[model samples]
Target: MVHVYGPHIFHTNDAEVWEYVNGFQRFMPYKNQVKTTSRGHVYSLPINLHTINQFFGKTFRPDEARAFLERQADKSITDPSTFEEQALSLVGRDLYEAFFKGYTEKQWGCSPTKLPASILKRLPVRFNYDDNYFFHKFQGMPENGYTDMVGQILDHPNIEVQLATKYRRSDRLDAIHIFYSGPIDGYFDYEDGRLGYRTLDFERFHFDGDYQGCAVMNYGDASAPYTRVTEHKHFSPWEEHQGSVCYREYSRACGPDDIPYYPIRLVEEKALLAHYVARAEREKGVTFVGRLGTYRYLDMDVTIREALDTARHYLPRAAARGHMPSFLEKAIAC
Candidate 1:
């Protein structure tokens, strides 16, 4: 049985997904404002110039901000081997501690020093006043909702969606080809060991008016139990409502029953993943796709792009080969 997750905020860099979503008539565009709560004050995320200026109480122009950050950056860390080291090298001690250290520890359920440097590499520090969370050229959400957009996408005559259906491995054992988007380790039934994952618990509540006055407000303080609170109404600013809904997100280690959100690819988890990959390589007539299938963290856009690429590669080759093609080329490489 497949249990699909609910409502997701789709943010992508892929032009195809961007164009496809834009084709929808009820699309709404809003500049992303991801704020962080640190030291009882809210600051713009991605460490933009405004955040730096506000945090340090200085009016720094672009060049001045760049120079100021350079001064804050630790020159001693010539080679960063961990996420903490990487943050210290890029931003410095104060900003790193206030914004990254506690939040990261809560999110991953581990010290930043134990995580990979690649985790922090994706975050960009801006020298300008731009507070947009993502710098993607095409950035927006559906005006109506993600549910409505997905319903529109699934309105095809050729496609059939069976909701509340539970799919089991035994049921598809004899199938010629199978495209699996579930956890790769789950496919093998966790023979080696269960791969680590960080899951989230969201506490939903209703507010009479604007609660945090933002779409996303992250709690950077380690003392804070929850990681972030997302105001749902702010996501669709085009629509007006008397009341607002928000979710306070708490990150925790994924249990057997919980839905996995972020893949925890620590040293031990990587070893476990390697074993699963080897097993998948030897398996026949099966291909793994998506973040969980490939055991990697992927954003909405990259996931869609990969899905399109996988289909493009498989459909053409499968017919000519007269057999199911191997797993996704990229997944196999990973």
Candidate 2:
């Protein structure tokens, strides 16, 4: 299969998953420290004390810092409902509007007020100076890049892959069962209304020196069109390069004909997914998997683990039932 998309970072906290990946490629230890253009000052992400102090233009002790934010917060907002409400309740309207509102709008193509609160819940208001982006137990990119690892994974003699072959379910393959990694909605030819999705646009630039100090920089201001820029060379800190490659990521609403990157599975989309799943259950010979196949955003590690689980669990069951093994079976069970 072609990796038409950009880089895929594989990271996980599971030991078994780590071991399995290590069998194919070595991993390098890397951490992400992103910067954001908030109000005008460049500050570390997750909005720690350094960011707060810089934004307000005042220094405060630990206790005073807590009190400073309390004043900014909307005391009247007893129960924060949406992302806007939560932001206003905790950090006041000005800061939230500056750093969050536009970025969220550009990323999801919807106002933060209209989006789910859980999406913005990941942000932190730190009293101390911990600038590390994610708190995950394990984090790193592949030493040899993702394309190489995937090539190695599919190198088994038992497996044969046709790179550009467009498959149809009705095609005659009398003895061979099909393992489909295409969109679920497409598999059924959109019997119902199309599912909603958000696709990304990447703008690449070449630079001589480090264009940005960090690998990622978030444009929090509402005026900026792109959400963030990622420097690929910095992703692999183990090797240094004279030239660096970077990508500015822009988010937009996906059309039915467009390549879907992230499924906007609001209440309506879930109902549609249920429909496709029910239809899949009726068809016994086919199995559907992967991001586009399932119409969901999955991290690389989770995708690999789920793939291995699908193979291991369904193989035995298919043999016992005297039917060809289908990767799609028992997916929901996992």
Candidate 3:
């Protein structure tokens, strides 16, 4: 199968899934260090200490840093309800409006005020000088690249993968099971409205030397056309390159013709997902798996873990029935 999408990084602590994937391909340890530009001040991403210091123009000890943020926070609102409110109550509206609001709007194609506060809950604020984007104990990219890793996964002798294989309900299915990773709404031909998604457009560039001095650089201002730039070669630092390739990612609402990049699980979309889930549960001879099937955004690690779990869960039922595990039929039907 073709990745079609951009680079995919697999990082997980699940031993079973890790072992299974590692058996197929090896990985290189790579950490994501994201930088951001706000009012021409360069800062580390996830709003770490360096970011706060740069934004506020102050240097403080760890304890002093905590106090500084506390002073900046508006304590009237006990619990943050919306992205706007969260920012206003915690860090004042300046940081939120300048750094988050515009970028969120560009990425989601909606104002941050319209989005639930839960969307911003994952954002981090480090009181120390750590700039690592993820808190996970393990993080990395594939040495051989994601396309190679996926090829290895589908290389099992028992597995048959067909690229450009369009699923027709009328296709002969007397005996095989289907593991579908297509869009949920598309499976039923969108009886209801199509689920919402955001797609990315990449602006590529070739440069002799480093362009931005970092792997990822976020343009926070709404005036900025592109949301962020990623240097793909830096993703794997084990190798050296005289030149570099970078992509400026622009996020926009996905149309029917566009490739869906991220599922936008707003309130209405969640209701629609439930409807699809119910329909899937009642159907037979199919198993819906992966990001597209599940209609939720999953990191590479979680996706693999879920796949492994699904396989394990269905294997026992298949053994009892004296049949090979049909990814779709055995699990969903049972």
Error of 3 at 56 (Å): 0.5
Q: Give per-residue CA lDDT, model 2, range 1-334, as digits (tens).
A: 1122554555578888988888877877877787898667788878778878878887877788899899999999888878898899888987897788889889888777776565667778888777877666777777887778778988999978777776776763553456677778788887777777898888888899888877789999878899988877878887778887888888899887677887776667778887777787677677788876776667777777878887786678667765644334444322
- Model 3 compared with the native: what TM-score? 0.90
Distance from true position, residue 93, model 1, in Å? 0.2
Which residue pairs does candidate 1 place in steric collision? 1-166, 1-167
Residue pairs with colliding backbones in model 3 are: 286-328, 287-328
Q: In order, what lDDT does every prediction score?
A: 0.82, 0.76, 0.75
What's the TM-score of each model vs. the native?
Answer: 0.93, 0.86, 0.90
Least lDDT summed over 10 consecutive residues: which range in candidate 3? 325-334
Candidate 3 C-alpha lDDT tens digits along 76-162:
878877777787777777678768987888888887777777777778888888988887766767678777877887888988876
Find the candidate with the highest TM-score and give its number: 1
lDDT measured at residue 170 in model 3 versus the true structure, 0 to 100: 55
Q: Which 10-residue span in candidate 2 carries the lowest summed lDDT?
A: 325-334
The parts of candidate 1 lying over 4 Å away from their true place are: 1-9, 23-25, 322-325, 329-334
Return model 2's CA RMSD, one decimal. Answer: 3.5
**Deviation (Å) of 306 in candidate 3:** 0.6
